[model samples]
Target: MIDKQIIDSFKNLIDGLDVDEVYKKAIVDFMDTYDGNNTNEFYSMLVAVSGLLVELKDLRIVEHGYNLIEEESEKTQDELDSIIRQFKDLNDGKLPPDPMVSTLEEDQVTD
Candidate 1:
């Protein structure tokens, strides 16, 4: 389902990172703590993890000469901030519609 896709995307996003088992456990626990019924919480966590991945990738880029453009870093930071804001909004009970679900609905409507 769409919820699985969100979790899968988060896992894929962190595929190359060298994070500790604790961090990984925390992610799993966080995901498990929320059922798919709460799309806002699920996506908030997803975006939060994505932001963490952005920071981790930034650090890796600096550690290794990965040709990461300065503009890209800036953009990623901006995105992290936006993601944080969205998470906060979700926590505040402003449930934003899930993008994947919305797209699927649109496609079904068209069909």
Candidate 2:
């Protein structure tokens, strides 16, 4: 079952976002394609269009591949650290007892 607190928090986050002009400008290339309609000459127009296409391809950021990979990695690292801390608490800040030490003690008792 989903928790009510989590649902409310997420809803609040969605409600608080502001879409300003700077954000719109960042996604301008996505909203429209400029075909170099700036020039009357055909070849000159194509050169402008090609430059825009290359710029689009070279963009460092913009909803690329969903961006979930880095987020998931950070969550995984946090979980691992938590587990290690719990283990250290259980073992009194030392390594776990070795299985071989128990077997050797048993052998000495039998001999």
Candidate 3:
């Protein structure tokens, strides 16, 4: 299953991107439709969507001759890189175990 940490990281990465509020919302809404059991497919979809957002931002800057927000493009790219790294760590079994999982296990034991 796709873990909660990955979902939260993806949300943060999307929020950090230089996109319009409407577009961002749309992206998040679309992400919600994915089945969390398939981590590889989800990661691939996220990469594609992130690339599209970057391309759109770059196009906007070119068409308008100035960035809508200072350093937005660079910031978005950096966040994307971070998100990708997290995904890799997760796939390699390098990510720390989720705290909630441990908490739940404790609760079950006590019950």
Question: Which candidate number has the best TM-score?
Answer: 3
Question: What local lDDT does model 3 show for residue 77?
Answer: 90
For lDDT, candidate 1 versus 2, the one ahead is 1
Q: Is candidate 1 or candidate 3 better by lDDT?
A: 3
What TM value does model 1 have?
0.39
lDDT tens per residue, model 3, 1-111: 887777878988898888898888987887777567778888888888889999999898796765545467888798778767777888898874543242335567642
lDDT of 1 by residue, 1-27 (tens): 246776666665555457656776777
How does candidate 1 score on lDDT? Answer: 0.68
Candidate 3 regions off by >4 Å? 66-111
TM-score of each: 0.39, 0.35, 0.53
By summed lDDT, which 10 consecutive residues of candidate 1 come out lowest? 98-107
What's the lDDT of the predicted structure labeled candidate 3?
0.77
Ranking by lDDT: 3, 1, 2
- Regarding TM-score, does 1 or 3 come out ahead? 3
Error of 1 at 21 (Å): 2.8
**Poorly placed runs, candidate 1 (over 4 Å):** 1-16, 63-111
Candidate 2's TM-score: 0.35
In order, candidate lDDTs are: 0.68, 0.49, 0.77
